[model samples]
Target: MKVLAARRRDAEDIRFLIDHLGLTNAEQVLALCGKVFPEEEMPGRARLVLGDIFDDS
Candidate 1:
């Protein structure tokens, strides 16, 4: 969880849109996650709550 937060912060610090892509909608966020972390192949339709992104929804 900490690692994820740290990497996200680093991406934001560098102003990398592709890395820290939490726009204002769930749909876009899901799509961005798919492109950013394709190897994980995260389910694009899963609900995204606050806190850990890997937490079971």
Candidate 2:
């Protein structure tokens, strides 16, 4: 899966979650959006969109 973070900080947070939390893939990391920002509101929510590099299918 692909993640679309608004800012560099958010990207860093996502990476941390993935590494520290032992998330298997991008999808899992995206699921922790709320956990990352529980109290404060997140201006721009990150998107976990997938992309295709080549048309192999």
Candidate 3:
């Protein structure tokens, strides 16, 4: 349950990056995630979310 909620949050965060922040690609997502979550694994998770968005498109 926690994992599912986290995934949902990641998707929302990625949407914000793409829609509001104008981030449209993996490199942009990774770069922003690196800055926001420097010591965490969020960059990878963000990439997965971004990938899912790409797959959907």
Residue lDDT tens for model 1, 1-57 = 222243544433323332465454445655666676776644322343322333322
Pairs of residues clashing in candidate 2 = none
Q: Candidate 2 — what's its lDDT?
A: 0.44
**Candidate 2 RMSD to the correct structure:** 6.9
Poorest 10 consecutive residues by lDDT, candidate 3:
1-10
The candidate scoring highest on lDDT is 3
Better of 2 and 3 by TM-score: 3
How many clashes (backbone N, Cα, C below 3 Å) per candidate?
Answer: 0, 0, 0
Each candidate structure's TM-score, on Cα atoms with residue i matched to residue i, is: 0.37, 0.38, 0.58
Better of 1 and 3 by lDDT: 3
| lDDT tens digits by residue: candidate 3, 8-34 | 556655566467767667677567656
**Model 2 lowest lDDT segment of ten:** 48-57
The C-alpha lDDT values of all candidates are: 0.41, 0.44, 0.58
**Whole-model lDDT, candidate 3?**
0.58
**lDDT ranking, high to low:** 3, 2, 1
Residue 1 lDDT (model 1): 24
Instruction: Write the residue-wise lDDT of candidate 2 on 1-57 in tens digits.
Output: 113444544555445545676766544544565566566443434442211111111
